[model samples]
Target chain A: MSTISLEQIQREMAAAVMTPLTPDDNMRKEAPDGRSMERVAASFIAPNSRLTSFERLEIYNRQYWYRVLGALAEDFPALRTVIGSRAFDAMSVGYLKAHPSRSFTLRNLGGQLASWLTTNQHFAARRADLAVDVARIEWAFVEAFDGAEHEPLTLEQIATLDGGSYLALQPHLQLVELTYPVDDLVLNLHKQEKRQATEAGVKHDEDDHAPAKLPPIRRKPTYLAAHRVDYSVYYLRLNRGEFHTLRAIRAGRPLGEAIEAGVTTARVPAARRPQLVRQWFTAWAELGWICAPDLDRLVRST
Target chain B: MKNQLNAMLLTAALSGLIGGTTVAHAATTSASKTTVKAAKAGLQYVNGDKPAKHSCKGKNDCKGQGGCKSSDNGCKAKNSCKGKGGCATDGSKMPKAV
Candidate 1:
């Protein structure tokens, strides 16, 4: 028996687990580096009294794909609904093939999905843009839901800040400007799914059944602020002006400049600009979107 | 010591290949553990409140049409628009300003 190094064993285990499982005969043919499935299985996996070597190895292969496929589906139901299940399944296979799970956690599984959807148009077919929008919003939801928490800016802090001060938005707050009203569409789909689950008296689990088809989506420009407050995610629909201003602020613009940019770009009449800005600021402050700068970090950096 | 160093190098190489510093940081930091629960807690489906009712053009026009009077903040009062295709408050309504 040849002594295999730990690296070789780890690499072989990784390779074997990633291979898509097939029927007994075909499994060997698809083994990495033209090695027979039995050969590869015997080299890495130990056979039990009840289970053959190939069967033992098959467990890992099936498990790897199943776990990742389930995670991706859970993360991007709207994307799956937009593209349909068959295409979604194929897309998952292709995506995992292109970008396999390297992280210890499954939360980062769909991190590259937006960019992947951009390049892989075939998966989305005619609804590529809509698919991309859904992917971005869903990913944003994932990030906002549990990405990071920051100290929220208080009304007192806002009062004390000078015009030269730059405001930082909370790390959990994500600003998404979508071409279509994808925010409403995603929300509606979730509503429909929940309603269906209630009616059927079955708990809503993504792995249980295929998501029902969604209604046709209209192409109206929509702005959404996905933020977490008290450990719950909320999607606030923003007008164009509010979106731009918030976008500016999140990009590290000064408070005075961000307000000015929002007012100028507002679709409403000039007379309404100031009121709109005030309303937006009041609402944003209430929602705790602004983050107070860390004085310790500032002092250290200086 | 040499074997330990090699293992550390391998782990570093694997981390680089995976390439999510936040997630890697999360693996080491206590904060990341709380994140898993927080993320799941926030995944509860929340539907946006219905668009605020517009003013009627005529006196009779507003009659029979389901419209909740908007407060000064532009959001309907709590339980004001309930059950009328109003906002689907999953249970608790978050304070929202339209």
Candidate 2:
């Protein structure tokens, strides 16, 4: 008798976005409510000669899931190899449930997948921490490669740095500390995946094999420095001394204090300490990883 | 009075027939409105033919094979393995209930 309420139409739209449609589902406008799922489905598509409106809607519903899942699968190839196909697909579905696509672009679909994987019930049963670590590394690679770039600290700026000034790293540069050799594992798994892909004419759904359990991490926490260099991206791993020194510098400590912190954290040998510091500074300078202090402007203001 | 009632009934029936068929005609026009169905995906190297930008469900249903690989990769078709062949390259194939 009256027009369909906007709220009812919206509810149906949300339902369509979230779930798959069936041919038998009541989407036709024959009902009194005028909110038939059939009409809503029909509105989005034309009636095909072969298939009904419900059947046509199924194509889009399935494609939406497949596209999002495909992006996640591409981002975490190593993770897929470790968990196998079935478990990975299940994990992907669960992640999508918790964090649906909020961004306009599908590229941002799996923004929260790494954290979700870390806490997922399935992951906890296996190498949950390792999975998260691998995901973090993979995401960092994606960001570094595709993210916007800025002017890196030039060699000229590093040459004139004052002794009392501290160096600042770029905001894009990210530091990650992990308990597992996730980087190595991720690389190894990718290689194995390529081999398996070549051998099989078609990938089987049964490729979901449990990953081998890893030995307990005995080394100090592994430090990773991720940033873009020139047009390319690279992740230069840091040792204990290097990691501590960079951490102190990033904390706005003066060069002397940063060196002290590195010594305290890593217990550098007295004989090799000076050489290590020199080498570290030279490497940082060469890589243009450090920004000079803006002391001249500060002085003028004061 | 009886004749007038019969004339009204005939008019109502004729209108109903026109209304239903018109709705059907509108639907048919909408279906064939578009001249081009599939657009070019632009990756000429992967598959020999220019990839179809648009697709339908059974388009890749892979009836030729038992099942089709389900991937959301924008480059490849959903169910059908265009020219790249099956999941041999990407290792993406349909999951069968085991």
Candidate 3:
């Protein structure tokens, strides 16, 4: 105790607290670094009149799991809907075990969820692809809500650019290519959650809100731009051509090349190409999704 | 020739944006509802008035947010939209992880 530094104490306590809970949600009798759990707790945490050091430390262990699990639940309520409360809870535990709270805020808790789901598809259960889609769209919502915003380039500014001029989307803008039209599914789940939250006057616990069997959602190839307008976010559906074009722009293709790339992929015939592309630009401008990149920020955001 | 055609098309698109007359949430907003295929959950109101709300830190300030906002501060001006930012209202840093 005399020689141990404060940093060493923090590292030890954090490790002990973050150890995985047993299936029954109790602290293990052992620690990862191969020390007696009781002795480890007694060294750092002092025992009080009633509770021993190990017992007091157990409270923190239980709480560390509870708080992180709950925060994950809030961030991905819709994913909880797609996969039941039991599986979501279990998967969340695994996710946290794999990717613990690295950032200062829990806002980035599910940052790697969609990517993680791809590798851990078993947690997705019967509808693995749909679950992945739901996770992707849900994470997009988190990003769009708090991700950075930028002043969009004006029409006049856009006009001067040749095909080679670089352009980018707003930092908060997220382009998601999903297999199912999960945008609607998430909207329905969140709306249901809000209504229930309002009526119950409190949010639901995991077991409390184990949803009843829902009609299976069908697969539909969907292209979406999850973007913020005036601070409120929306899922703007995009045609394939528009999706590819915008993707190219975000990828740092020049304006002319990006448009050409999009034009080639346009599902509509050449005659209707101009009309659809026109509609996309008008909506994007109105929504302020187009931005002139700050080179450093652009590199990091992509 | 293809580049010329693209340039022409780009010009027309820019013209619509600059004109600012045609309000085009059509491709964006209209399609959101029209394409819904979903399963709804928790329709029953189990708790009345002040229901059984729970928070980790014991203060219930955060409203449940979905893919959308709970209380929409609809677009006030064309440029500024209302959104719910971070809501960690525990008023203390120690219990933030709790």
Instruction: Give all candidates' CA lDDT scores.
Output: 0.63, 0.54, 0.68
* DockQ, every prediction: 0.03, 0.01, 0.10
lDDT of 1 at B62: 26
The predictions' CA RMSDs to the true structure, in order, are 20.8, 26.9, 10.2
**TM-score of each candidate?**
0.67, 0.59, 0.77
Runs off by more than 4 Å, candidate 3: A206-212, A297-302, B20-98
Q: Quote the chain B TM-score of every prediction.
A: 0.20, 0.31, 0.24
**Which of candidates 2 and 3 is the stronger one according to DockQ?**
3
Model 1: CA > 4 A from native: A22-28, A32-34, A199-216, A268-271, A294-302, B1-44, B47-98
**Candidate 3 lDDT over residue span A1-302, tens digit each:** 55677888798789988998888777777998889889888777776555667766776787677767876787787889878888898889889989997765565678899999989989867867888998888888767655677767765676676556788888777889999877777877877776877788745474644533667668888988776543345677787888898999888887777777887888677777777777767667666677786889657867
Q: Which scores higher on lDDT, 2 or 3?
A: 3
Colliding residue pairs in candidate 1: none
Best model number under DockQ:
3
TM-score of chain A of each: 0.84, 0.72, 0.92
